[model samples]
Target: MTDQVNANSYLDTDSSNICEVLQILGAKWAFLVLNELLRGPQRFNQLQRNAAVIKTQSLTDTLRHLEQNGLVLREVFPTVPVTVEYSLTEKGSDFQTALKEMNKWVEKWGKPQQVNGKTSISS
Candidate 1:
């Protein structure tokens, strides 16, 4: 008799780690907000302006989640009305290396093509 392979056999630790990371960054606004912060610290208004397409509420929620995950830091100044600024934590800054690698991978193997009004990546 021939041996059969299990379809689920490919699941492994690396896949689990990737899945967990995606869960944290997969939100519509999370990566966008993080990318903006990678430039440096900025006030809420500045982030909203630079991110352009993100709504005020969505930006607020994304910042809150990033802060909770220790990927961002929120600071408040003792100003008249209270000023706030957001910056990436060390953990967040470390992600820049990974981003660079992903960008390189895209350059090498991620040619985009239009298909029925949608875009798709093809090697």
Candidate 2:
């Protein structure tokens, strides 16, 4: 399959349109990381801890991908060992509102699916 890359993202350009926005949001781990950042900005380790089952490589890749896509911002602090934190950009924060609405909708009428013997999205 041909990798879509910017074909689906980047709405401000002539190459794409708003209709393709889902291609950006639907990226793997995109929404998950966005949801975590919705709580607040976090260091890489903190993000890893909060995301739980996500592997280090996966988190790193996702963060890099999000940053590249202009959805997440990465700030590097000047310190002894240096610290890096990730937070959502304005576009990303806007996307969080959508995810929150989806969560609310899911809670209201989403089907009950078995996940590890408990309901999916169960805490």
Candidate 3:
């Protein structure tokens, strides 16, 4: 019989600290929301329409999570009707640079593959 071992057991270095940051950013719909806000501030409806992949409740939750993590800034205007807008904070801007770098890495080393019966790519 062959010995069973966990893949992570072979790695020598610990990345638990970095994993926490990744965990926050790696949530579903988080990156998409950030992408929408990258260009400029957007209203809730705009983001909802742009990210059709995300459910409204999930998007709202992701936005709150980003805001709590200092990656998004929510602004409220007191007019006849309330106007709420979301923008990337300075921290979020820095995170965008990191995302760009990640994109570059994927472009260089990733290849298209079939994942879960769906065409996808990985780096």
Candidate 4:
């Protein structure tokens, strides 16, 4: 039998430390939420609307995850009725720089393509 070659063996896993970073940011709606916040702080509803591509449930989960990760801060305004808004924390701002670099990489190197019109990417 012929030897089977593995394509991934050629890659240096350590060089892709950013993979973990991207994984966190790659969660559904996470990037979009960050992109929205880049514009400025916004209410929950605004985020939901801005990240319309993500399901409402997914967006909710993404926001909670980001908040838990200390990348996003949730604020409550004391008024007759409480108003909630989300803004990026210092950590999140630092992450934005990474994301910007990632964006530049994408612009220079073509984005991953869809195979057979399928919407997902496989390892």
Candidate 5:
């Protein structure tokens, strides 16, 4: 762990005090939603389409959670159908560094696990 992360008083990184925020981010589709936003801003339907496995309701719930945590910004434009865009905030953008590290770790150490006859990656 880096000194910066270790010095962050906001997060109790100790094993017994795992942050609740981590649980929120680890929620279904949350990481994927954040990952997609890292590429650029996207509309609701675009996120749904790009994230094929996520249902509409799941995406809605995850977006709400991310927004609540100040990781995402939702902008609504006054269009005919009311276009809504979601983009990462500065905090969220900073989080991408950690995600990139996690991706590297997964690629190196993760193994495939079977779930209902399908292969899924697990560490």
Candidate 6:
């Protein structure tokens, strides 16, 4: 085999790390949740309200998944009734650059169209 490595070698399907990251990010609300967390730490209720469309169970599941993946940090504070907040870990914050690039790409090429009353991109 040639010594030169393909630039996209890490994107191969067999790359477990890449696959895992994709799986985590491919979840329905992952992007939105990450976008929200990029701002700052937030409580469960705040995230739920900001996300607008996610159900309680779905948000919980998403947060748990993010936490399990080392992308989100969950902190519990001692208070009258106890308080919990979620924020991005270093690894998660590192993903911001990728998200910014993705935003750039969308702005460059995404064509918004009406699809069943929902806004979708046209190829």
Scored by TM-score, the top model is: 1
Best by lDDT: 6
39-111, model 3: which lDDT tens digit per residue?
A: 8999999989988889999999999999999999999999878999999999987888878998998877789
Candidate 4 CA-lDDT value: 0.79
Local error of candidate 4 at 104, Å?
1.6
Candidate 2 residue spans exceeding 4 A from truth: 1-19, 113-123
Give model 2's TM-score versus the native structure: 0.72
Cα TM-score per model: 0.80, 0.72, 0.77, 0.70, 0.75, 0.79
**Per-residue accuracy of model 5 over 1-123 as CA lDDT, tens digit each:** 688776775455563355565776877888899999999999999988999899999999999999998899999999998999999999889889989898889977789889999987875
Q: What lDDT score goes with residue 97 in model 5?
A: 93
Per residue, candidate 4 scores C-alpha lDDT tens digits across 3-87 of: 3234454354644865867667777678788888888899988888887788878978998989988889999999868899999
User: What is the alpha-carbon lDDT of model 6 when measured against the actual structure?
Assistant: 0.89
Arrange candidates by TM-score, highest first: which order? 1, 6, 3, 5, 2, 4
**Between which residue pairs do clashes occur in model 1?**
none
Weakest 10 consecutive residues, lDDT, candidate 6? 1-10
lDDT: the better of candidates 2 and 6: 6
Q: Per-residue lDDT for 32-101 in model 2, tens only?
A: 8999999999999999999997899988988888888889999999998999989999988888777778
What is the Cα-based lDDT of residue 115 in candidate 4?
Answer: 88
RMSD of each: 5.1, 8.1, 6.8, 7.9, 6.1, 4.2
Residue-level lDDT of model 6, residues 1-123, one tens digit each, is: 333355356456458777777898987788889999999999999999999999999999999999998899999999989999999999999989989898888877899999999988764
Candidate number that wins on lDDT, 5 or 6: 6
Residues 1-123, candidate 1: write the lDDT tens digits: 123234344456558889989877877898888889899999999999999999999899899988988889999999988999999999989888888888789877898999899987753
CA lDDT of every candidate: 0.87, 0.83, 0.86, 0.79, 0.87, 0.89
